[model samples]
Target chain A: MTLVESLSTGTGFWNPLAWLIAVLVAAVIVYLIRQRGESGYKKGTTQTVPFISGNPEPEKEMVHVRASNLYWGYLDALKGYYNFIVPAHTGVLNDYVLWYLGTTAALFVVVVFI
Target chain B: MFWNLPFIAVVALSLIGLATIVIKKNLIKIFLGITIFESAVNLFLISLGYRAGGIAPIFTSAPSTDMVLATPQALTLTSIVIGVATSALLLSFAVIIWKKYGTINTDEIRRLRE
Candidate 1:
């Protein structure tokens, strides 16, 4: 098999060995730095507890970060876009199929006409 | 009449799949719709290379009649494998969603939205 060659039509070339070497070098640097860092973790101490604005920590389940709660700031900033987009997602299976059919029909019409 | 049969079946199968996807609320039903859609696509591809009485491309004896094109079959095989993987991944995600949210209803699972 022809391996590690540039595309016949493109100028870009990729070599697997080069990528492997680069990744290894980067990993070694990260490993060395991590080894040198202070490992001051102590069990059964206040240091082990997560600090939450000086307030007593809530129960583990209560404090668990749910997937939906993530990226709050980003979502808030894009509230206008999400308002239009989120409702369309509806998590409805039929809606998803409708979107696909609509797109396919649109493409068919476009291809036939133009 | 017979020549257009597969093409008609392809369109019907895909339309049925799309309808199923749109009308179904259960996650498993939606996945089944996806599988049906994939089957329709694979059928369409295989039909594209159909010959009235074509022989397999593999040769072990003297040269004979024209063989059906192999590329589309290869592509359909690859697509089938990918579809299996995608369906498995989607079902696993469904399981995870049920575990985390205690329900599989898309509307009820909208914890990410404000």
Candidate 2:
């Protein structure tokens, strides 16, 4: 009812006013931290180039990250789960349909019986 | 329950349509499923207007005035028109996708495909 109070969503509440204040506070904190960033590195020099784990940097042309490699760490951490899930995504059309129907039937059974 | 057979058919058709969309990889099949879903909706609208032994909503019938509601029929007509447009657009997109990708499998259309 009030501007500062959360609006009830029946299952949850959201307060735009509170979120706005939080965002403003976070922005101020970020600005302060940015002010502390070291400007010791010379611009338009070798110092501007990215350091590769204390090794010589590769060619600037090959500096880009591949799309699949972007999530390498996350995928490695969840390798066990991904092992089952990723292989299950066989490019075959029929298998995907089977999965969809299987999930729907399972949910229907659960909803009806439980 | 026998009297509500059309309503049951509507539910079944809707579920089938949804299953087709989720399970099928062929873009054309997905469009067909969309059409089926739209038909199910149209069937639902038509069924909702039905009265026991009711004749068509033509006032000029000269029979008893116990006729099915006409508003839902009009709504069904509008729905069919929209469905036709949607199917056309969907098929056109499917054609374009096939031409560009050379395959219709959804798995092959993945963004991270190396």
Candidate 3:
């Protein structure tokens, strides 16, 4: 029985074969959609180079992207939140201890209340 | 409530150690606090298996077979052995930190470094 073949956890059931078939079907649909993409796009050329006001693309290393730059947009959006947090990180030993103790106390409070 | 004295002591020692670790800036003091906390944990383990009028877990020709659980005692011994090694390692780290940084003050040590 297909239903009996599923792994059950009382409230939920999962069949790996069924999941694989669904994923395969979804992949086929995605492939069909990709076929309708822009016809002007070529396999490999300067046309594929990122738009930089029609200027020659620089080398990969010349880009000089920092690790922090990867999350620049996210950090910029959360500037207000970081402004409050950055100043609090004094790196003082006592402050670190207090933060840990405070967190532990919070956990204990949650355990007792919940 | 009379039988809960050891448990209460375990709680008190743990809290005191945690407070010491949090409030103290000195690395040596923090290590001492860690030792205190480890001792508290070991005591807690020993207390868990305690029983009145209990003899050693060894199979001796005793009148009654009332023996406390030996597993917790063994675990406490192992904890103590590990605690000794941890204290030694932590102290060495503190020594290295002091040698490299000139000052042992945690606040001063947080200065910008290349």
Candidate 4:
């Protein structure tokens, strides 16, 4: 059978190609809906200010809040639940690596056992 | 029953995740939506690895003629790794946003630095 003829009918719901197309369509719809009637600046705006290496310019309407302050507000609202959460305040990349390792190990264990 | 159940669950989970990300305004919740999406893909990959009346993909003497597919297992592993990296990167950006504006609300964020 030719490849064209084979793919003529539905490949069934279980087909990976079908699933991928579904995902792509969903993503496109979401993006288009988000883009409707919005200014170009808001559409592609980056929240973070780009850091130019070693060139500190005049700050224009830039608000720099302390990391501690931000964490405190989020945690304060959490009340009893705040103690259980791990705060990702450390600027070091190693902490992220460790988090990835821990979560991956835990997920692997869960998948293997059940 | 097992052969088709996973496919149905994956599709359902994908729809749920897509809805969550599309409807939710909170950045953290959006990240959770992505996590859910990744989970659905992982489940799909795992389902693809299953084989009826088959043994594990291990080489042994007198091994069963039918062995579970190995490619999906590899794909699942890669998906999990990529999921971890993407989540970490997104969460890190969330942290930076919180530090910058002292607010996690996406609506509130838009009002600032205009």
Q: Highest DockQ: give the candidate number.
A: 3
What is the iRMS for every candidate structure? 3.1, 4.8, 3.6, 12.4
Put down candidate 4 lDDT per residue, B7-29, tens digits, no spaces: 99999998788666756767798
Cα lDDT tens digits for candidate 3, A1-114:
755498997999888888999999999999999898878877798787699997987998988987866988898999999888887888777787788889988999999999
Chain A TM-scores of each predicted structure, in the order given, are: 0.54, 0.50, 0.52, 0.28
Off by over 4 Å in 4: A1-114, B60-66, B111-114
Better of 2 and 4 by TM-score: 2
lDDT of 4 by residue, A1-114 (tens): 333232444653344566678899999999999888566554445534466775775566465765666777666888666455433433333344356657977999999999
**Candidate 3 global CA lDDT score:** 0.86
Model 1, position B2, has a per-residue lDDT of 86
Local accuracy of candidate 1 as per-residue lDDT tens digits, A1-107 = 56755345466767777788899999999999999999999899999878988999898899789998999999999999989986876655556667887998999
- Model 1 chain B weakest 10-residue run by lDDT: B105-114
Per-candidate TM-score against the hidden true structure: 0.56, 0.54, 0.63, 0.46
Q: List, in the given order, the native-contact fraction of each candidate.
A: 0.41, 0.21, 0.48, 0.00
Deviation of model 4 at B109, angstroms: 3.4
How much lDDT does each candidate structure score? 0.84, 0.84, 0.86, 0.74
Question: Residue B60 of model 3: what lDDT?
Answer: 77
- lDDT tens digits, residues B29-103, model 1? 888988999999999999987777678777675277566668988999999999999999999999998898888
Better structure of 3 and 4 per lDDT: 3
Instruction: Mark the 10 consecutive residues where model 2 chain A has the least summed lDDT.
Output: A89-98
Real A-B contacts recovered, model 2 = 0.21
